[model samples]
Target: MCSIWRTLQRGTLRDIALVCLAVGVIGLSYGAVAVAGGLPLWVPVLLGLLVAAASSEFLFVGVIAAGGSPIAAVLAGLLVNARHLPFGLALPDVLGHGRRRILGTHLMNDETVVFALAQPDLPRKRAAYWLCGLGILACWPVGALLGGLAGTVIEDTDALGLDAMFPAVILALVLPALRDGETRSAALAGSALALATAPFLPVGLPVLLGLSGLVLAVGRKRETEVIR
Candidate 1:
């Protein structure tokens, strides 16, 4: 295992490990919430491994548990993960070729992309990307398994206040990006639109409507780029 991760520097290793620890905690919450909501233990565990996008998984679980259609849940998940299109476009080299590319894409998330971009060289970028991605892959499922087991013994998840955790964690994850003016504007607009339409629209459809705020963001970005 040490040899496998020999390419990562000590600082890189430490930062990635910290991120893994945080993700593990979020995964634990996801597992506990899902199981307590009446999902099978395998459901959350399998979703953790397969979906690998915490926010999207949370949205899916929330929608489904609220009596939304499976299609609606899946559409919401897709909308949340659409950011990966840009992610893939920016990191083709780190994704390698053929089988490695497939696995790299599967592991591709915001954390891995940010770490890869922060590195000074391509080799270091690849090292950081794979290290962080692999770390999260391992941590998420293990945490989910433990949380699922714990959920089995807990009789009242709502009383324990697990219900509010999904959105709270999602908000925490996106809070860092909101420091940017353009992103913040778009987020506020999108969020307001979603909340407004949520009363009349189907569970997942409001999220799609929320995405319309991206047009304003894209237009603003273009204006700024032209000015520069």
Candidate 2:
């Protein structure tokens, strides 16, 4: 355990700071966009409470703005963020045992995961926990507040192209992780399915298809590894 903790602390604090900056910028941009999109002031504030993925937060806001029911909105948010479940399951081997570890496991998110996974030589658990914990406690909420405030003052959100930023950020963040053939194929297939269903189904279907795609990617990855 001592060795594990030491290993965790070895990550370059500088790198962690860089990851935090990325998250803060993207999160703040989202809050500003949400407000510019006509979301209530409380919307961005409350979103910070969830402390989940900013991408899912953007999707959740879209559903609410579209007049979707609250139940459907919640379902959509959960579906889009479902990938976190496995992320948590895979975390413990890195995090070790205790209350702080447990809490950190729950807070592990896309940005944190990216930062930690990319640092293959560092203590995986420690780097992951610190990076995510700091981001959750500071970066996201602060960004939201700033963006929300900025949104209130802007008269022409439409002209700013704020709406496109959410999808753009999501793509920029997630696309880099699709390095393998199976993961890329799954994303493409899921996106195709989502597009095909977009005209018929409303809010929730795209998320479901995305989840389906992720599951396929995971299963296919396991199968290929087994063959090797």
Candidate 3:
């Protein structure tokens, strides 16, 4: 507990709080959508607590709302979230080992990963990762609970512009990653594949297909090797 307090005082807490505020707002939007789509209030609340992956939760809720089968929804959610496999691979050091790794994996998300990677050193990275992760874990579920209850009263959350927040937040996150040439190339290729396939494919499949962007990364690596 004392260590936690010290961690909070270390200054990354402010950034974590700010990001979690956005996450909470997004969580509220997600809860409202889930209830409005005919899910029980507890569904979104539970998802916020357990699933905790905003994109996957949104995709799952959407599939269910569209009358997709539960099995199909689950598969879609898994497909959409498959990128986490690479994330886990890339951050093995930050994730640690044994019992702590279980909690670390659960807390892993785009914001936490980005915040941790942006830090200058290993200690700061670990601190930012855990702080952002734990903070989001708290804020997300609370926001979902409140939103689920309020969802019954509110009819059109889109009018409040919450609908735009998710993509805007995602774009903001990806923009920084694009600073790297290889990453930028991969993103462009992935986006093109996603867009081209979106009309004919199911929601999550486009994202899965976008994984082909790794080909660009491979090609970039080979080119760099040749140049060297």
Per-residue C-alpha lDDT of model 1 across residues 1-228, encoded as one tens digit per residue: 464377777877887788887788767777888887778889888988988887788888888888899998999888767768767998999988999899899899888888887777888888888888898998998888888888755445467565565455446556677888888999888889989997986555666676778787888889999999
The root-mean-square deviation over C-alpha atoms between each candidate and the true structure, in angstroms, is 5.0, 5.4, 3.1
For 179-208, candidate 3 gives per-residue lDDT tens digits of 998888888898899899989986667876
lDDT pick, better of 2 and 3: 3
Q: TM-score: which candidate is best?
A: 3
The stretch of ten residues in a row with the least summed lDDT in candidate 1 is 165-174
Q: Write the candidate numbers in order of decreasing lDDT.
A: 3, 1, 2
Candidate 2, residue 37: how far the Cα is off, in Å: 4.3
Q: Candidate 2: lDDT over CA atoms?
A: 0.66
Q: Which candidate tops lDDT? A: 3
Give me the runs in candidate 1 sitting further than 4 Å from their true place.
1-4, 152-228
Instruction: State the C-alpha lDDT per candidate.
Output: 0.80, 0.66, 0.82
